[model samples]
Target: MAQVRNKQVLLKNYVTGFPKESDMEIVEGSITLKVPEGSSDVVLLKNLYLSCDPYMRILMYKDTPLSLGFQYSPGSPLTAFGVSKVVESGDPKYKKDDLVWGVTKWEEYSLVPSAKILFKIDHTDVPLSYYTGILGMPGMTAYGGFFELGCPKKGEKVFVSAASGAVGQLVGQFAKLTGCYVVGSAGSQEKNKLGFDEAFNYKEESNLDAALKRYFPEGIDIYFENVGGKTLDAVLLNMRSHGRIPVCGMISQYNLSQPEGVTNLANLIYKEIKMQGFIVSQFYPLYPKFLEFILPHIREGKIAYVEDIVEGLEGGPAALVSLFSGQNLGKKIVAIAPE
Candidate 1:
């Protein structure tokens, strides 16, 4: 088989503070369309869409276990969740023309281990790009974190930080669906228009603690923790007795050299708060149940998902960098190959 040009987004070096587009470089490489001979349990893919997530920033830092023991390295293609089509398969579970979503490199084509492929795309009725956002990891994160860890009840009051992003938006909607009163915090009022019962611009608020008190005079029953730091500190002060806080991502602290400390954690003991940090992978067992619950809502338009899509692999670096700056209006995605 002939080798095809593979354009990739490579980490230029370890990042510090904030990531700039210059931190990553676009380079042209070559790959054969075929899986290597005698290679079992590996599949060749034609990558279509790439997900740009805040967690990817953590992996860019050198000597960090966030990359899972150097899974990513400088001068190598950045890894991310992506939607792809199988070109050739050395695994029985997949075959030619199979559609899948899972961990893949930021390039037009990839040769990845079959184990990394999370699931075959069974529901093509929806947009394939949805796998990069609403129907993929972020969706699962919101589902597992909110339903499993938060364990909210009807008529409960829920507050979500960074509620405009992929996971936060879904968490707010899920809370509402469960008959909870939902409030969301976003950088701008426009971004917070995702059907939450109430929305606040945290940037405009002089005091987040006062802001939360205003939103929930009765106190929050469940706090979906997305942006940590000051927002978390404020939420800590307002949690009702036995309130659950499902800590997902601490986007506010990801880039900081020294993360801000929450001085109000003593409130946890005083209020009997149940605060737990979680990674989405821990709840993969619930995925089948999650799909059954969410897919119908999606098909019927009972749920809404927003995405900010940039075209081509060349735009990957800027799209990834924009996540930290709030430049993208919604879930950031790169369309390497549109279907």
Candidate 2:
């Protein structure tokens, strides 16, 4: 195959405070449309959908703890969860045109080590872009963090922060499935359409603690913690005894140079709350289990996922920066190429 021009979104430098579009640039790079000779287990991918998530901001750091997983280097294309078609491959497990979802470069084409790919995407009945979100990493995160750690029971009150996001939206729906009362808070009140019993715009609330008390009068049994900082502090004060807090991504503090301190953490001791932070990789073993559980609900029209998609690689920078500014309404995705 011939070499082709690959448009890529590259990190210009390490971000300090809030990120702007200027922090990344779209550049034209070149790649052969085939796996390099003798490159065992290498797969050449035609990138399709790139996911814009809050955690990507963590990787943009010049100094990140090694335990945080991968980090982005200046002058290189960003890596993220994406849906792609295999253009060529040296691995027998994959072949030309095989649809897969995994960690792919933010470029039109990527030559990746097979290990980064989670699995081949088999079900094509639903939208392929979903692999970047509800059916992908975020889905796994919500399932493991909520079910595996949350341990919800019937008639319990559940609160999800940043509830309109990829993980939060699904977490709210999953809580409903478990027969729990679900209330969510976001910058906007769009979560009501996603099956949240009540949705509030946290931006409009002058006092978060008062807002939570109004909705969760009896106290929250399980708080799916997505936004940290002030939201977490308020939830701590409103928690029921022996409540569980599944610490998902803390979007509120992602772009902060110095993250705000949570003043009510002492409530964790008084309430005997169980709070645990998790990485999605710890739940990869549950992918098959997750698919089995979610796919049926999806096919039955019992669940919904919203995506805020931007077309082309040129829009990638703005789409990514939108995550921090709360500009994206749902799961933010960049369509790099046509399917």
Q: Report every candidate's CA lDDT.
A: 0.89, 0.90
TM-score, cand. 2: 0.98
Q: Per-residue lDDT tens digits of candidate 2, residues 1-339?
A: 677899899999998889889999989999878788898798999999999888888888888643544579999999999999999899889989999999999999999999888879999999999999989999999999999999999999999988888899999999999999999888874545598898899888999999999999999999999989999999999999999999987888988888999899899999999999899889999999999999999999999998999999999999988887764579999998999
lDDT score of model 2? 0.90
| Displacement of the residue 151 alpha carbon in candidate 2, Å | 0.7
Candidate 1 per-residue C-alpha lDDT over 1-339 given as tens digits, one digit per residue, 9 for 90 to 100: 799999988888999999999999999999999988998899999999999998898887775656332366788899889999999999989999999999999988999999889989999999899998889999999999999999989999999987889899999999999999999988755754688999888878999989999999999999999889999999999999999999998888989999999999998999999999987888878878888998999999999999888999999898888888743457889998867
Error of 2 at 183 (Å): 0.4
TM-scores for all predictions = 0.98, 0.98
lDDT of 2 at 108: 97
Against the true structure, whose lDDT is highest? 2
Regions of model 2 farther than 4 Å from truth:
66-69, 189-191
Instruction: List the lowest-lDDT window of 10 residues for candidate 1.
Output: 63-72
Error of 2 at 95 (Å): 0.8
